[model samples]
Target: RRPRRSAGPVSEAESGGSQGVGAPLGVMSALEKQLHLGRLPPRPPLPGGGGQSGSKMRMGPGRKRDFSPVLWSQYFESMEDVVVENETGKDTFRIYKSGLEGPVLLLLHGGGHSALSWAVFTSAIINRIQCRIVALDLRGHGETKVRNPEDLSAETMAKDVGNVVEALYGDLPPPIMLIGHSMGGAIAVHTAVANLVPSLLGLCMIDVVEGTAMDALNSMQNFLRSRPKTFKSLENAIEWSVKSGQIRNLESARVSMVGQVKQCEGAASPECPKAIVEGIIEEEEEDEEDEEGGGSVNKRKKEDDTETKKEHLYTWRIELAKTEKYWDGWFRGLSNLFLSCPTPKLLLLAGVDRLDKDLTIGQMQGKFQMQVLPQCGHAVHEDAPDKVAEAVATFLIRHRFTEPIGGFQCVFPAC
Candidate 1:
C-alpha cells in the first residue's frame, strides 16, 4: 500500500533535513569548497603568442586556427550542431539534431543541466536507431540564453521548446516523441498540454513529478531564509561536495561539472559574471534578505526571482528536497493535462527507491503506461543508461516507428 499523503505542506528545511539525516553538512561543505577550487586546469599559452609579452598579439585571417574537434566530437556525432536565435533577440539556443529518415525525438534536459547531459545516451541511441533526435539546452541553462527571469515561466519555457522544435522540423511530422527529465519534463508536459507541439508521439518523463517546480521554489526560499552566507572560497564548495557524497565515486567528473557551472579565479575573490550562476545566487540572497522584512513589492520581485532560480537547480541536491512534496500537485495536474493527447505514453519509474506509488499510479491512469525500473534511482539515465536506451528503442518500435539495428535488447544487463 502507498504511504498516506501528508495533510499539510512540508517546509523545504524540514525536507532537506529529512534527506540530510546522518549526513554531515559541515564536512560536506568543506569538501564542496575544495571541489570548487580544483576546477582550473593548467593554462596553455596561446598560439602565435608568448605569455604576458604577447598578450596583445592577434592571429591574422587565413591563419590555421585551433579546431580541436575532439573536445566536441562526442556531442556532434550523427548530429548537426546549430544555433537558433529566438524572436526575443535576447535568447538563443545551441541545438543538436540527429537522423533524417525516421521520426523525431525531442530530448530535453533537467534543470541546471545542459544538453550535454544527453550526450552519452544520445550518441549510443542514434547509432542503432533510425530516428531523428533534437537535444536542446533549456533557456537559462547550458548554451541557451535568457534575458529576463520572467522568461523562465512554464509558458515561456514551453515556447522556447516549441521554438526549437519548429526551427528544426517545420511541421514535417506528427507524433514527435517528447522526453524530458526534471524541469525539462515539466516543460515537455506544459508544451504538450498547450498544443505547442502537434501530433505528439509519446511522452517519457524521467524522475520528475508534475508541478515539482513551485514546491521546489517555496522550499528553497524557506531553506535560504534559515541560513544565508557566502562560502569563503571555492575550495570550500568542493569540500562540501566531497563530504556530502553527492558525486560519490566520480569525484573528478563532479569536480569538472561543478567547475563548468560555478568557478572564479583566486581565493576570496568576487564571483564570475556567468549569468545563470549569478542569477541563481543573487535570487537566493534576495530571498533571504526579503524574508528578513522587505517591503511587499520587493518581496514579490524576490519571490519571482526565486522561482526563476529554482528551475536552474532542478536536477541537483539544491532542489531535490522539495520534489517529494511538489510532485503531488505536479502529477495531479499532469494527469489532467496528458489526457488530451492522443498518443500512447510511457512513464519510467525507479523501482528500487521508495517513491509515492499512489501518485505514480494515479498519474498514469488511462493516459499512459508505466514501467518500473528495478534498482534504479532518480538519475535513471546515469544509473541504467543501457536499459533506458532499450526501453526507448522498444517504445519506438512498438509504436511503428523505426527500430535500431539490434532491436530492443537490454543494454544494461544489471538493469
Candidate 2:
C-alpha cells in the first residue's frame, strides 16, 4: 500500500462486500471474493501526515485513521515459545494462550496469516466459555522459527502441530479442540487423521472448504501477485489492509496485522509497531470513508519520487506465491480427511456455496455440524469474531466439550 496525498472522504462498502451498502460501492473487490484472502477490488493508495514528508503531494482533508499494530498480550493471557525437536534441529513455534485451566482450543491460522489472527476471537470466546486457547504461529508464518520454513507440506505441518502440543502438554494432556482457518483448517484435518492430537476433542474450520479451496487455486497466483509488496508505514499497511478488505474489523486488523508483515531489510518506518494494552483497543466502523480515494491515490503515486516509494516500506513476512508448490497438498482430498477423522467436526463457512458435493452429502448424512455466517469475507473468524466465538462456544457447550464461564449464555446458529 502506498502513502500519498489523501482525497476528501471516499465511500467503502459497510461490510466491504455486496451487503448493507449502496450499489456503486457494493461490488465486492476481486480479492474479497476468491480464496482465503478472497476476492477484493484493487487496493487504493492511502494518505498519511507525519513522517511521510518525502512525498511531493500535499495531504488531503480526509481524516487519518490509526493503523498501529496491537500487541498479542492485549488479547491473550500469555505468549509462550515452545521448542520442538526434529532430525534437522529444534524449531521454536509461537503460542498465544488464555484461560489457565480448561479444555484447550488450539487455533491454527491460514496461510500468510499468523496466530494473532485469532486475537479477537480468543478474547471473545474465553469470556463466553470455560476453555483454554492455544494459538500457534505455524512454520514459515508469524514469529515461528523452523528448521525448514518452506516445508509447508500437510504431513510436515501436521507433525509440527502434533509435536508442539506434545511439547506443551506431554502424552496425557487435557481434552483439546483444533480450530483452524483456511490453510490451518487443512492442517487440522491432517493432524486429526494422523492421530497427532491424541487428546483431540473437536474440530472446527472457519471459511474454508475443499471444493472452494481447490477452485481458488487456479487464481491463487494472480491474487498473490496483486497484493502490495511493500507499505510506507505500519499505519499505511494497517489502513490498506482494512480498506482492501483483508481484515474487515479494524480492531482485529490492528492486532492481527502485526504478524503479517516485517520491516524491509534496509528500510524501516519511523512509526513501527508498538505494544498497547487491550483496554485502549476500540473498534471503529469507518468502512465508508474511502470511496472517493481513487483520484487522490493516483495523483500522489504519480507525483511521488522513487526515493519515497522504495525506502521505509514494510514487506509481507511470507510470499504466498512461493508456497504455491505445496498448495495442492494442502487441500487435495481434504474433505475426505476431515470426514474420516473420528473427532466431532464443525465446518464454518462464509458462504454455503463453498460446500462441495462430498461435503454437502456428508452434511446431509449428519456426519458433522455446519453453520454458515453471511455478510463476511473469506477470513470469517477475523471479519466477524464475536459471531464466530458464539458459534464455537455453542458447539463446544452443546457437545459437552466445555462449559460456559463468566455467566455467559449460549446462543445457537449465532450471528
Candidate 3:
C-alpha cells in the first residue's frame, strides 16, 4: 500500500532515503550539500538579442532542418537534467536556475504536452527574475514513459511530485511557487493540498479550474480520437496538428511535434489502393410488406476486400492509455482541492469563460487572486506568454518570492 499523506509537509531529514538522478557527494547528504552550498552546475548566460533582433550566429549549411530556433539556442544547454525515483517509478525534470540563493518555481505542463512547453516562458523568467525554475514531464507524458501503469490516481501522481520536490529541495528550501496549466493545474492543487512541498509560497493555475465544462472535456476527447495513430513525416504531423487546432503557432507546433515523435524501427510499408466492387444481385423474393408499399430488404451485401492494415512502428511518445485512466479523477480532484487546499493561490484564465461559469471567482476573490487575459486561448502561456510571465512575476512578488523588477521585458525574440 502507498503511504498516507501527512497533514503538513515532511522534511528530508525525516524521510532519509529519497533516490535521485545522482548520489550525493562524499561525507555529505544531498540535501545538506545543496543547502550549505551550490551543488548544481553553473548556468550559462542568456543569449543576446532580447526582443525580435536579427540572429548573431551564422547559418553555415545550405538547407536548415525544420526546428524551433528558440529551442535550438544556447539557453536550453544551461538547464540541468534531473531524474528522481520513488517506489512507483522514475521521472525527469529540467531545472533552469538563475542562482542558488533565490526562490524556486515548479512548473507542470498540461496533458498532451511535455516539460518543453515551458521552455519559452522559463527562459523569460530566468532572464528577468532571480529564481530557479523546474519543469516536470508528468508520468506517461514527455520522457517519463510508463509501462503497464498500475496507478493513475491523482493521489499517486501527487505523491510522485512530492517525492521529486523532496529530492530536489530537501527538508527546507527557498520559497516555492507552483505553476501549472490545464490538467496540470488540477495536479498542482492536489500536490498543494497534500502538503507535499513545505516551502510552497503560492499556487498558480493557468486556463484551468475545478468545474471545467463537460462539453469542453468531451470535445478534447473527441479531438484526441480524431488524431491519426501515426504520421509518416514530421511535416505531416505538424499539418495535422494545425488542422486539428491542437497548436496555433507554427514554429512552436513544429518543436512540439518533433519532441513528441520518434523514428520508426522498421522499413516504411507501401500503401495499397482499396478495390471497389460494382455488381449488384437482385433477390427473387420480396417482403410481404414491400407489396403493401412498405420498406423492402436490400440483399446487396458489401464486402471489405481490403487487406489487413500493417501497424506503423512510428508513433507519438504519449502514454495515451495511462492518461485516459485518470480522466474522471482529474476533474473530481480539482473540486476536492479547491475546498481543502490552504495555500495562497492565483488563478489565470484565458479569454474564454466556459470553464469559469461555475468558478464563481467573486466568492473566492478574498481567499485567492484571479486574473483573466483578453484575446488569449486555452494555452494562455503559449498564446500570450509575455502577459502570463509578467502576471506570474507580479504574483511572485506579492508572495515575497522576489522584489518588484521594474519594466519587465520579454526575454525571447519570439515573445
Candidate 4:
C-alpha cells in the first residue's frame, strides 16, 4: 500500500491536536507560537561536541550513574561503547554494543530517539541468545551531529546503515540481522532494498506498518512539535514524557531520556547541587593532573579544558524539526517493498487493537512471519521487554540465525 499524498497542507489542529485530554489547555501556546514564528528563542549556549569530542566528559558519567535508581541499575556494566564512521561523509556516530558473539544484530531506533532506546532489552536478548547486539545513535540524534540536513532522508539513512555495516563487519561480514523500531524500521526496509548489507539474513519491524495512516504521522509530529525543547531537570523530562504517552513507565522513560536529552555543561538543575559538585570536582582534578602523566591523561586534560570553556544547557539531543521532514515520505509503499525483500522478514505488532484489526493471519499469510506482543505499545521493547526478547529469540532460532539456549532465564527478575 502506498501513502496517499495530500494536495494541500493542513493546519496544526488538522494535523492533530497538540494537547492531549490530560494536557492543560494553552499548554503548547508558546511552542505553537515559536513553530509558526521564526527561530525559537535562542537556547542557552552549551558545550559543543560537534562529533569530534570523544572525551568521557562529553557524556557525564556521574550524571548518568545518578539515574540508575530509576533506570537499569547495571546498565553501565553491560554495553561497550563503539563509534562508527560513514565512509561517504566520514561522519562518526556513537553506538553501544553487547559483546556476545554470533550473528550481528544491528539496531536502528525511531526518530527523536537514540541507541539507548534499546537499553531495556538489549542485555536481555544478549544474555538469552548468543549474538552480538549493536545499537546506534542515528544522524542528528544523540552523539551524532549531522553536517547536512539532507542526509536525514530515508535513502541517506539507509546508506549510513550500510556504512556502519561495512565499518563494523568488513567487506564481506558475517550474517547480519536488522531489528528496527518505528522510523528505524522504515530505514531498515530501505537499507535492505538498497542491497547495502549483502550478508543481511533477516529483518524485523517493530510497531510500523507500510502505508501507515497519515493521521498517525500527523499525531506524532504534533506531539513532538508541542514538547518543550528543554527541561530544567531529567526528572522534569521524565514526568513530561510519561504524561505525554511517549513512554508508558517512569523507569523506561528515565533510561530513554539518557539518549534523548543532553545536559549543556553550564545548565544545572534547580533541584540538586550536582552540577556545582561536578564543577568543584573538575577543578580539584585539574590541580592533581600532574600525578598521572601519560599521553592519555594529557589528552584528557585537553578535553577537560575544552569542556570548561563552553557553557552547557539541558536540551534535546535530536534535531526534531529536521527529522520530521521524512515522516510523510517514509511510509509510502514501504510495506510491499519490504515484504518483497529476498531476505526473510518478521513483523512485530505491539498495539493490541492494531493486531486484532489489521494483522489477521490470512492477510499476513505468505507475506512474512508476524507476531503480536500483548500489552505492548509503540515503544515495544520498553513496554514489554521480556515478551519482545522471547519473541526475538524464538524468531532467530527459527531462522537458524542462532542456536537455542535451553532453560532460557528471564532477564528481569519480575518476569
How does model 3 score by TM-score? 0.65
Candidate with top lDDT is 2
Better of 2 and 4 by lDDT: 2
TM-score of 2: 0.77
Segments in model 2 whose C-alpha atoms lie over 4 Å from true places: 1-64, 267-311
Candidate 4 — which pairs collide?
A: 46-311, 46-312, 264-312, 264-313, 265-312, 266-312
lDDT of 4 by residue, 162-259 (tens): 97778776787888899999889989999999899999999988988864544477677676667775555566566566555677655667788777
Error of 1 at 280 (Å): 24
- Stretches of candidate 4 off by over 4 Å are 1-73, 76-89, 264-313, 352-363, 409-415
TM for every model, in the order presented, reads 0.57, 0.77, 0.65, 0.66
Worst 10 contiguous positions by lDDT, candidate 2: 275-284
lDDT of 2 at 8: 40
Greater TM-score among 2 and 3 belongs to: 2
- Alpha-carbon lDDT, every model: 0.54, 0.80, 0.61, 0.67
TM-score-based ranking: 2, 4, 3, 1
| Residues 298-354 of candidate 2: C-alpha lDDT, one tens digit per residue | 343434424354445577898888899899999999999899988889999998888
lDDT of 3 by residue, 1-415 (tens): 2333323444556445453423233334557556534644554444543321222122453433343323524334355646776575665654443434467788888877767667667656665566777777777666664443345567877876787788776887668888899878888888888788888888888887766634466566676765566654556566555445565555566655655655455444322112222221211223243566644444222321122122333356664544665777877647546645677777788744644443565335466667778776577776666677778877776666685444564322111
Q: How do these models rank on lDDT, best leading?
A: 2, 4, 3, 1
